[model samples]
Target: MALEDVSLHIEPEDIYGIIGMSGAGKSTLIRCINLLEKPVAGEILIDGNCIFRKFGKFFENNNEPELMLQGAELRNLRRQIGMIFQSHNLLMQKTVSQNIAFPMEIAGAPKHEIDKRVSELLEVVNLADKVANYPSQLSGGQRQRVSIARAMANMPKILLCDEPTSALDSLTTNQILDLLWDLNQDYKVTIVMITHEIELVKRICNKVAVIDRTRVVDQGEIGQVLLNPSMEITKQLLSGSRGTRG
Candidate 1:
């Protein structure tokens, strides 16, 4: 969690990948964007506004001043930027449709809109038939698809994935990756993914960033970085040379 001087701009509608071995700070980097782990020193701008500049100071003062947003600003930002993790993270008791509808329900979307959106999203993720199934009844890939549908329920502008395919078998991994590619094409949603699998980045990411020891060692177009890695750490990662797996 010691990210140092890491800075990058993700363009609109771009699929950016962060690649590194374990303990390489990839997860920390993404978490920093949402201030999940505040950087000791750095600016985090979202949509050109510096959200983290005074975060620490604001929390420290604790004036409890009546302010705008009612803490919903941060929640709204998170809603617009969806996240998927290595674990499917579905609620055990919720049905597939219920899981996909969870976010919209939290946001208080009207019932009609929620129903329409959930149906369309289930079809998009090819999980329409599993709407009534519980998490325990679905395969790993199906579970992940349910998670994806849930993440997209709010129509996020950006999607963050953390080692999304690490647990799946090779064939399921490929199918999931292809599904992600299709999602990107159809929705034009900006994606930022963290994974140790370089091949996944090659297949889906347009831009890549290599991190090591809490620092970004390399960043560029995937083709350029893969073909001619500039940093030693980047070379090691791209060459399939494992550092500690983080």
Candidate 2:
């Protein structure tokens, strides 16, 4: 794979959006942040720690032994970051509450604590009554809501959304965006979303980045970048409006 240079700083409480075409490398950029795709060059910093550059070598071997992490440090880092995907990735056999509670269970939260957290999450996503319903019973939008609840189960400081609204209809997309905005306001969680939706960027994103050919072409405040797009590719994307809308 060819190397691409990209850089951006997302502050806490900011809704950062990355827009691009299907092969524009949006997915690769997000994966690089979590060290899921190791970049041959460049640095990825999370909360001031250079996690990628510092630990890049650790991922060299797919079968590398898992090193014991100091309990508090590992817990703190993992609990502070959350991720949600377009697929909803819910357990078909599990109930809504159970799916939302899965992460907390993995982290070894007490039973009472898990229950309370799940209740709060369901309320946040407006799925309080569907707690007992399974994924098979919920609509695409509802399923995405459940995924959001699960992602936020640990009250993460940073939330990564990879084409989160791609499978939903317009109405549901708006609802989900509103929910995310609400979360940003209520919890001050920094949201980094990867999508091909120009409308979505105009609607909720305060900061926007345009990626093309495995590199970021332009990025800035939404209003400024949209008004005076610095890159030709960005102007083309905006003009054609061929990107993903949902």
Candidate 3:
């Protein structure tokens, strides 16, 4: 239900991944990173700055902390981190460009700057032609691409993605993966992808952390924990694919 003592170090420009079985608290960790789901304890740091310092140290019966980011501090810190969900939480009523512009508008960016960034992101995502389109008018993969564009609108240093590829078919999954990989290379953004699929990690992530029972059981380079897996869950994750390959 909650992550416990999970500490992860995602290198800059690395495609880091978090994987586990359902109810393993991986999602909770992702939510915590973005401050979407407040934690009772521990602090989230981005590039040596404590973006959110939560204080539920002992998991008391509904007691709260005295200090953490608030108002402008919280809002400013949140701007540095961007999040996308598996469901592609886009504004159905807005056009693709408008959806990507939502965050900038909220931040009070000038209309000219918003127009410039929206145009740039559309090209980066290869959805320039779909700028006038709505979420309902695009394919699943296209919709996710738009979401990725939106997530990068502010040029965040870190991107938090929760099962962004879970809704796509195999071919489209790879396409989205390629786009993410390109984003990492081009923008030098650190990407943290959360998923249940081991193959997804193997294919894209250079580093990974495995979560189980609200705790991180394994974490390291892909070759270590994933390729030559040491933990039971890691072995189990590789088992099906290994079996298939064998």
Candidate 4:
């Protein structure tokens, strides 16, 4: 029960950021959206579908069972949504190409198609030359780029990033943010990023939600909150946020 009464909307083609302190249920909220962390109540609707809403006795038919997605149905839905972690969860033993192609391979894509898509994704993430390289051979930033490519391998409608750039330095973080922006523009993928850095939000996010103590204290267009913060936590976060974004 990390989150309580937390709600937010993310539009298509959005790079939405969820900003908060370390223990503010930021990860829990994002995980709930993907069904990683299930909430006891509340409906999480994506594309107007309530993924978490229970059925059975709660549905219109009293005798019918819960209309929950399971097996292939759930897998198919998950395929349409991609998620990346704070750590580069690459296959250490597999080459970069193989890691990027892992999901497509699992979904039974053809060898030729996997190869072709891997090549295209590598190019997109600017890692074409490192196709044969393993995760151990790449730098932190390069590994993150490869993870991003893998996340997009399925051409998902939504991409969930959990502290995508927290491990990198300021320069590399900026680079990764720029890459995310490029992906959002090119693929029209809706992005939901979880982060503790407000500067990161100002740099990339269009809409944002600030969470604290399992609750969302403030949220709206990034411009509004950044320019004029209202809540005490929001003001504190903004005050500590470094740099002056243009």
Could you report the Cα RMSD, in angstroms, for every candidate shown? Answer: 4.3, 5.0, 3.6, 3.7
Instruction: Go through the candidates in order and give each one's C-alpha lDDT.
Output: 0.83, 0.84, 0.86, 0.87
lDDT at position 244, candidate 2 = 30
lDDT of 3 by residue, 1-246 (tens): 877787788778889999888778878888877677787777677788776665663545544444467788788777878888899999999999999998888889999999999999999999999999999999999999999999998889989999998888989999999999998999998999999888899889999998877889999998888767778877877777335333
Best prediction by lDDT: 4
Clashing pairs in 4: none
Q: Which of the two, 1 or 3, has more TM-score?
A: 3
The TM-score leader among the candidates is: 4
In the range 93-160, model 1's lDDT, one tens digit per residue, is 99999999998999999999999999999999998899899999999999998998998999998888
Per-model TM-score versus the true fold:
0.90, 0.88, 0.91, 0.92
For model 2, residues 132-235, the per-residue Cα lDDT tens digits are 99999999999999999999998889889999998888999999999999999999999999988788888899999999887788999999999999998788
Ranking by TM-score: 4, 3, 1, 2
Taking the tens digit of each residue's C-alpha lDDT, what string does model 4 give over 1-246? 377777798899989999988878898888877777776655668899767665332334534333445678677878888888899899999999999998898888899999999999999999999999999999999999999999998899999999999899999999999999999999999999999898889998999999989899899999998788889888888887543221
Q: Model 1 compared with the native: what TM-score?
A: 0.90
Off by over 4 Å in 4: 55-67, 241-246
Model 2 whole-model lDDT (C-alpha atoms): 0.84
Give the range where candidate 1 is weakest over 10 consecutive residues by summed lDDT.
61-70
Cα-lDDT of candidate 3: 0.86
